[model samples]
Target: MEAKGDGSAEADKADFQKMIQGMLEKAKQLKPEELVFRYKGVLYPSVPSSVQTLQALGNFQARPEDLVISSYPKCGFNWVNLLLRDIAFINQNESEDGKPGVRSQLKLLEFENAGNYEEMKNDPSPRIYGMHGHYNNLPSSIHQKKTKILVVFRNPKDNAVSYYHFCQNNPLLPTFSSWDEFFRNYMTGEVCWGSYFDHALVWEKHFDDENVKIVTYEELKENLAKGVQSIAEFFGLSLSEEQIQKIAGRGTFQAMSDNAEKTHSSFGKVIFRKGVVGDWKTLFTKEQSEEMDAKFEACLAGTKIGAMLKYDLYCKE
Candidate 1:
């Protein structure tokens, strides 16, 4: 009886320490105002990637061979996460030989275990990772290594709509009840990730490097087979074309949304919701589209992105 009590007491102490630590960390991070974090743009404050090294946030411990998926929010992050999840890790399929009951998906790839950047570095064997971080926030070391980066960019109009729902459901953001308030903040780049224009530009510039490759969410949606091939090649993974097609088919926007619903959230909503590319058609007014285009032109100026984007004309559906 005494020993059990002692064990409970130790657990309580550890929990208390964790609570206090979390509070202190939160205190250190700048307050979110109008959705933009004051000291945050690409750089984030102490956000731990793992329980082991809880405070070494944002710093990259990258090597050249590592694979990083960088995307703006609502830009196929979950799709890529699920894709890399399958490619990078596999479970022992009920082999007659006993292994632990089953493996948690977390143990499969590098991203599952990492709560922040630091933990992303601690994985084994050609590690794969994901982040919503803007271009400037990435570590210089990672850049110098010429680490293989897969960047996913989506049209900002749709991103804005998706981000609105995400923030509404996200506990961390100061919730605004009205779309009017949300759109104002979003247009001004006052939210967590900042101006979608600036963020996308940074990523586009990075793709100029040999090791960096850009993929569009629209392209991925239209033809996931090719998207899978592009990403797989970027990470130096070769698979048969047929196998790649299979992966693309399985990791669809609809499938992920349906699968995520069964999950119970300790946080606000289930992290993965609808993955459709252009719910914005229903949401964006003509004036809003024009206003959004002004930002796009300025950010995408001097690039051939305009023609490519014109041809694809995503979000029409």
Candidate 2:
């Protein structure tokens, strides 16, 4: 029995190593421009995803009770997902040892293979997905079913800084030679998931959409308890003040970072770095700041989402 168990463990290790090597080889095959592949005018990361996955997403089905947390890369996608999962677990009275089981990972709608999609479809209802694509790229069933969507966004400057660091640390992502090059690419919508402005603008039109709710990283960081309550209400799940406080306490940046290894595995460090509002001040050059400002004004000025960004407070020097 012991020998069989040891053999099974060894085989699992070998399979894991093989998967990693395959991913590295695929990353090596991509040219800089090919790092992010385009499908239907939107960009997706080439590593860990394929055109087939995107095609599968086009015909993907969504249940009405399904909830989605959508964001551009590095825009609090993971954090918000954690909170919503906690809310769901709490609301459903699904707790183990008096604690909410919120560490389970949610599926990324854009990265799943056909088999995975089938698995998700067959799984129980109230499925939560983390999405990083534009609104139009969402599964048509999501729209037709009026699935509730939560869109999380961050100020562009801070988002770019975080995204740069993430790329540098994540082997699955292509790294830039310098922040300057990355900044230029980011401003032009060359990065994975395309321009942040484009994403914000498209989602902006849905501000009044009954099924969609928008939140900001800064808003959550400022008063997480309030954010938690708002999200609970948005999901039609009423929670007591005590429950909100407990969830917010567990969802803090420091708490999440400390638990990242257990919750996110090897990618935790790359995902949860200095979750602050103005880290961009340390990285963005004056010219880059001006450029982002110009783009924001042109694309989102006077918009509801623009006001939510609080750009003048957190973005400007």
Candidate 3:
């Protein structure tokens, strides 16, 4: 029996090595010659393992009660994620100190830790996972089970501006020489994670699906109380005004950043840069703003999602 167990262990080791080799090959295929990697139209950081994570997600199983906080990169994922956690355990008043809120409570499908896959597979009910993948690329089981998907979108213009700074600040990505170069790539969906509009549109297609709710970052920014209420409602959680206030207050960019010691994973300040609404004004030129406006109108026209968001790019004066 011991010999049989040894043989099984060896087989498992071999399988793991084979999986690593496969990931290496996938990395080569997906890694871009430019700043970041792009695989099947999805932009990933320069990290080869992230590419593998995305590939692995193709086969991930999802339960019906699972809550997935998904967005194209830089679309308030961390913010929404924390809000969900607060709502989930508001009464518990769980402090995320050594407890590590997000890592301990939530699952990230594209998490760098491969062990998370097995851990999540074994985790208990009502699993909540976060991801930064295009809507179409979501795990087949999520669609099959009609898992509850909470998607967040920022105005494409704001998203672009935020993304520019993120790519610049994130050491994992290749930094651009100028905002102009980044803008060009972003407009064309050539940057990591591809076009903002494309990502939004894909999720927009599923707006009518019972299991999906698409919320705008602008909406969250506009009224955190209302945002929290809506999120709670979607998850069938009834929140008192007080509970709503707690969740909203805790989930704010300022609050998250201030408590980075407890809130952030290893990457602290990088995750919480300039989480404001109209900061785009400082960055975009008049011509660039006009161009972005025209593009937003052209691409988002006649879509319910576009109508819902009103497609405005400027931070309101």
Candidate 4:
């Protein structure tokens, strides 16, 4: 199937909207990327045009109050989304001392009010967004405004293993057999999203100036309470003890994976194989693990990112 020209028959904005509607009406006939809710790593049979339109519509300019969560695919994005949602809920109807409401934090969550990056950048007050885009690709306006970033990463081995499974089911990411092939691409930074080290380096380099912060899947899984609290402090929000428990409990891999399945959420890749860290130990041979570690060290040693990573040494007290 060939890509269709997005009908530009209309000269005016109103006419463009009409054509977009017409295109969207047939979007289901096209594919996921043509849909309004398309994410990367989700290919559409008819997508090149859709991708262009999406890029134009979703360009984020950034805001001083914006809270952007950046990560590669399968990098605890849902967990962070759930955490922020719960935090926002807790902050929604608090008492004078910022105590949480007795009712369920998520009970009233309509799950709307979030929009595309472009929409989010223009919104009043604080805006929160989760992105799988690389740092270099971020909008110039965002950099100009010095937008805050919360980054998340997982162990490369486990990340690769999970990515393999995800791409196996994903229309966008190629499903390849043999760890050698996958590792080759992964180490070369040619995998879907981008290189893990590059992503981590961008944050570490930018963190000091832009309020950029990082969290690890290992940390989030090892001590979820600390993870929640760490996130709270980073965002300059206070969480009650109860709210902490709720977010941590719900943000766990098991809980979030269950929620994704129950809600038929966008990140179904997260649910299919929500395995924990150290899965690398099971999946990678000793030589493979050592090879990856060597690559990581070669890529990031002595950098600020090196201080930020926990990797196989995660959970060391």
Candidate 5:
């Protein structure tokens, strides 16, 4: 939002102030250990105030047309965003500004902007919102209204590594001096937005729910056309093969990187680091890799999600 030349400088700054104000209020109430909360035996990177906020969110009012895109930090949230926008705008006339989504239409649950929330609350139907909240922390309205929810998850190995670099670059989060420190914090769920395992597994329980849909980052990356088609189908959007191809083309890493304004805005450039699968291999040492594997095995031994997510800490190629 500092503008640095993305063109939306003034507006970005205002929204950033709101986000910072929200985070500071939560930060003010944090105890040394309360920087993260342990709920249901899983650690979450939320302070006491946010925990209260999460409880309050249980009463949040949601509309039937609202769609919540949920995921842990750095776990393909942006990719899903781009894909969703492309799906929605594929055959339609492009915006006059040539942006992805209507700037005023976007909403975020994790980093709430008071201005944006007011706008979103009064906005038209079929509003799309993004959040990194765990399933238990989501609004009760989500279940009550049966508002369509899409959970996009990535392999934890890649997720952790991606998050480590993200912390180093993003001003909002604490920067780590080394990958070792970052990995230790991540394994213990000390980073912002909480544990990837908890976020994914909690949402996994709702995979069978009629209003919920889950997609893996690996599957999306492996065959984006198929991924786009599956997402379109889930969202009940109709598109032909040509349209699907167009969406996939524009949603690619290179294309999105080239058009950051349309893809990611307000500190989003830093969010667009290496968009690849299995980059964790370069970052993780043998011992760390084995440790993560053990943790994953122990945490997800009998859960279907272990396989559903294709959980392999050490992936070659």
Candidate 6:
């Protein structure tokens, strides 16, 4: 049994190395801008995602029972995705087969191939799709069906810092020479998925909509158990207190980080790095901090979503 396990581990390691090599080769073929394709004024990474997929997003059909997780990049997307999957799995009474099935099973609507949209259209009820796009760009059917949409956002300062590190590590994204340069691009909506503020403001308009639930990353971090319970309730799933506690404990940064290899494969480390609040303080200069603050004031201040972020508590030093 030990020998078989060792052999399987070695094969997994080899497969991960090959995947990285393929990404590096693909990166070599394209300029930084070519790494992403622009559609409807939003930049999407072109690696696993295609322009054709984005174009077909509008016509895609959505069922009323469908659930959508929408967020800009690096905004606790993985964390929420995992938690929801666990909730769904437990609700269904599915047994864990000891495989990293949850991450592998989830699909990003924007990143899927255009041809796959047809497959998704025919998929059965209780479907969940993840996406990063402007609120207006989602399938019109979603609105018509009143599909539940969970909009997860983070404070901009920490979001920017996390995004910078993510871009540096992921070959699918363009790298910057310095944080200052990246900060400038980030402020101007030059990064993948466009300006964070633009995305937030649009989603904020729908906060009162019955189908839309606004969740902030900081709130999840501060009280994950409570957050998980709220999310379960939003999804109309009833869970015992014990189940909620277990999900919360497993969903912490350290627990998820430790299990990333199994859940996320080689990309796990890159995706799960330092899931902490206020890391921006280590990297942001006084001026950069002020600039982000001013942008927040101009765009999100006094908005319902802005209050949800608790900006003074999380972003301010």
**Each prediction's RMSD to truth:** 7.6, 4.6, 7.7, 9.3, 4.8, 4.5
Model 5 misplacement above 4 A? 1-56, 91-106, 113-116, 313-317
Where does model 2 exceed 4 Å of error? 1-34, 94-96
lDDT of 3 by residue, 57-172 (tens): 77787888777888888889877887787787663444545121332132457654455565677866666787777778788899899888899888777788888888777655
Number of backbone clashes in candidate 5: 0
Report the alpha-carbon TM-score of model 2 versus the true structure. 0.90
lDDT of 4 by residue, 158-226 (tens): 778777677566543335677677777777766655577777777666656646787877777779988
Per-residue lDDT tens digits of candidate 2, residues 212-258? 99999999999999999999899888898988999999999889899
For residues 240-290, could you state the per-residue lDDT of candidate 5 as single tens digits?
897788778778876766666443444457767788888998899999988
Taken over the whole model, the C-alpha lDDT of each candidate is 0.58, 0.82, 0.71, 0.58, 0.69, 0.82
Residues 1-317, candidate 1: write the lDDT tens digits. 00111334344344434543553356446454422323433322223222232123334467887767777767766667667655543221222432222111222122222344435446465765656667676656677788878777777777788888876775445667677687887888766656777776676666578877777777778888887777777776776765676667666777655554222112213356666766777668787777777767667756644444542376443
* Candidate 2 accuracy as lDDT: 0.82
**TM-score winner, 1 or 5:** 5
Screening candidate 6 with a backbone cut-off below 3 angstroms (N, C-alpha, C), the clashing residue pairs are none
lDDT per residue (tens digit) for residues 152-208 in model 6: 999899999999999999988989999999999999999999999999999988989
Note the clash tally of each candidate.
Answer: 4, 0, 2, 0, 0, 0
Total clashes for model 1? 4
> Residue 264 in candidate 2 has what lDDT?
60
Deviation from native of the Cα of residue 261 in model 3, angstroms: 3.3
Ten residues in sequence with the least summed lDDT for candidate 3: 1-10
Error at 5, model 6, angstroms: 20
Give the winner by lDDT: 1 or 5. Answer: 5
What ranges in model 3 sit over 4 Å off? Answer: 1-35, 48-50, 91-106, 112-115, 313-317
